[model samples]
Target: MVNSFISGLAGPLKPDLEMMAICKVSIPGLKTGKEQTSEVKRGRDPIFNQEFFFDHVTIEDLDTKNVSITAFHHGGAKLGKDLLIGEAVVPLREIRELNAKKEVKVIEEIKQAIPK
Candidate 1:
C-alpha cells in the first residue's frame, strides 16, 4: 500500500508534493454541469465590466467509484462557450446490465440516435 511505503521515510527521502489530483471543483458541492453568473468588480482604478460567468460543476465519473452522490441540485442555463469543466461517460455494458435488473427501464441511448 502507498501508506506503508512512506511510513518511516524522512523529510528529504519523502517527496515534497504528493497526491496528484485528476479533477477539481470551485466549491465542494454547489453546481452540476451548469452555467452560473456572478459579478466581478475592479479595485481602486475601476474597469468597464461588472460581471462574468463562473462555471461550477458536480461529477459522476465511471472512471472514479469513490462516492455515491444523490439528491443533486438541478437546473441552469447553458452559455455559448466551448469549455468542458466536468464529464460523465457511462459505458454501454453497465447501462445494459442496469436495464436487465430493473423491471421497468428508462435509458437514454446516444449511440442509437445516429442512423447508419
Candidate 2:
C-alpha cells in the first residue's frame, strides 16, 4: 500500500484533489510491471489501502529488482494532465531483509520529483 502526503507544498492547492498511487516493478533485462490504485479524494494526504503483486519474481531476480511507488495528482478532464507529486524507491534486497526479520511494513519518505 502507498500513502501519499504533500502538506506544506508550495503554490496554491488545486481545486481537484483526486490522486492516484502507482507501483512499478523493474528488473534488469526484463519487462517492467506497473500497477495503480483508483483515484482517492484528499487535499494533501491520501491513503491508498491497496496491494500490488508481480508474478514470476524469482529469488534470484530480487538481487537486481526494485519497486517504485509514486503519487500523482489526477487532474480531471479539464486539466488533461496528471501531475507527479512524489515517489519512493525500494530495492528488493532490503525488502527481503525486512521479511526475514518479520517486518512487513516500511515507510519511505517520498522524494519530490522535479516538474517537467
Candidate 3:
C-alpha cells in the first residue's frame, strides 16, 4: 500500500514538484508485480490511500523477495520524459519478522530520502 509522499527541498535537478507513486513487489525466484497511485497535482505533500494484493504468494516466498515504491513526476504528454523523484526498497525479511512477532497490524513509518 502507498500512504503518502513528502517532497524534499528543491535541488538543481530535482525541484519541489507534483508527483505520483508506484509500489512494486517481486519474488526473486518467482515473479514481479506493480501497482500505482493517482497523481497529486501541484502538491509537495500528497496522500494516497491505496493498497495492493498478491495471490498465490506464500510467506516463505516473501523471505527472499523485495518491495520497491517509486515516485514519478510527469513531463507533459511527451513520451519517455517522466522524471524519477525517488524510490524505496524494502526487504521482506523485515515484514516477516514483524509477522512472526504478531505485529502485522502495527503502524510503522519508514523514512527514506529521495535519490538525487
Candidate 4:
C-alpha cells in the first residue's frame, strides 16, 4: 500500500491566492494515481491535513515507484489556469525505510518545475 499526507504550506505565498495540494503515486507499469485537497482561499499558510492511499502496491514496487506532491494556485493572475507553485518527489523505498522506523515525516523542499 502507498500513502500520502499533506500537512501545510508556509512561505511567501500571496495572501489573496487560492490554493490546493495534489498527491500522486507513480508506479511503473501501472496507472497514475492521484488525489487532491480542497481549496484553501486567501492565506499565505494553507493547512491541508489530508491523506491519500493506494491499495494495491506490492513490495517490489517500492524500489521503482515515486510519490509526487504538488501545490497549485487556483485561478489567480494566470487567469483560468491552475499555476504550479512547487512540488516534491519522494521515492517509495525511502518511505518504506522511514515507515519501519516509525518516523515517516519525510520533509522535502518544494522545487519549481523546470521549464520544458
Candidate 5:
C-alpha cells in the first residue's frame, strides 16, 4: 500500500487504471486543482477515508470510524474554500491488527486524533 502511494505520488503509474485513479486525485494548483485524495477503499460503498478536512485545516490521519460526509458544501468562490479533508472512520467490518493488544486501544487512538 505504501509502495502504491509512493510510486503513484512520486512517478507515473504503470497499470494505467491505477494511474488514472491517481490522476483522478489532484491538489490545489492552477487549472482544475483538487485536494489530494486521502481515500482508502474498504469493503463498503461509502468507502473508508483517511483524511478529514474542516473549513480551515486538513486532518490527514486516517480515522475511518467517525468520518463525516458533507451533504451540501458552499463557499469556494467567495473566500477560498473549506479544507479538502477526508472522513476517516472505522467501519464495523474493518479488519483488526493481528498484533493489537486490544481493539479499544486502536479505536481510542483514532478518537483522540479526530478534530473537535
Candidate 6:
C-alpha cells in the first residue's frame, strides 16, 4: 500500500492574461488509486491540502506509475472554457525505493510544462 498526500500548490503560470487561475492535482490509476484535489479559485498561487491512498501498489507498479499534478484556469460563466496552466509528472520509482529503506516521507517541489 502507498499513501500519498498533496499538501498544497504554489506559483501557477497563467496561460491567459485576463483569466483567473484555479488548480487541482490528478493521479490516474485503478478506481481506488485515482484521485484529484479540490479546485482552488482565482489566484496565481493556490493551495490544496488533500490526501490519497493506493492499496496493493507494488514496487513494479511504482516503477511504471506516475503522479500528475496540474494547474488549470477556470473561466467564468461568460467564458465556459478551462485552460491548463502547467503540470508535473512525478515518477514513483525513487519514492518507492526510499520508502522501502525507512518509510520515507517526501515533499517535492516540481516545475514543468504541461503535456500536449
Clashing pairs in model 6? none
For 21-98, candidate 5 gives per-residue lDDT tens digits of: 111132222132233343332211222233222222112222222222221112246535443322222322232331
Instruction: Quote the lDDT for 81 in model 3.
Output: 68
> Against the true structure, candidate 3 has what lDDT?
0.48
lDDT, model 6: 0.53
Per-residue accuracy of model 4 over 14-86 as CA lDDT, tens digit each: 6665444333334435454545355566666676554455555544455677776677767556567776766
lDDT of 6 by residue, 6-81 (tens): 3234344355544355545444674456554556555445555444455655545666777676666676787788
- Candidate 2 residue spans exceeding 4 A from truth: 1-32, 96-116
- Model 4 has an lDDT value of 0.54
Candidate number with the higher TM-score (1 or 5): 5
- For 1-116, candidate 3 gives per-residue lDDT tens digits of 22233345123434554444332333334453544345556655555444445444445555566666666666667545667766777776665444543323332212123233
Instruction: State the weakest 10-residue window (summed lDDT) of model 1.
Output: 1-10
Q: Cα miss at 75, model 2 (Å)?
A: 0.7
Cα lDDT tens digits for candidate 2, 42-75: 4455555544545555444555666666566766
TM-score per prediction, in order, is: 0.16, 0.55, 0.53, 0.58, 0.18, 0.53
Error of 2 at 111 (Å): 36
Question: What lDDT does candidate 1 reach at residue 116?
Answer: 61
RMSD of each: 18.1, 11.6, 10.7, 11.5, 14.2, 10.9
Ranking by lDDT: 4, 6, 2, 3, 5, 1
Most lDDT-accurate candidate: 4
Q: Please give the TM-score that candidate 6 achieves against the real structure.
A: 0.53
Candidate 3 wrongly placed segments (more than 4 Å): 1-38, 78-80, 96-116
Error of 6 at 38 (Å): 1.8
The digit string of per-residue lDDT tens for model 1 on 14-62 reads 3442211112112223234232222112122112122222232112322
Best by TM-score: 4
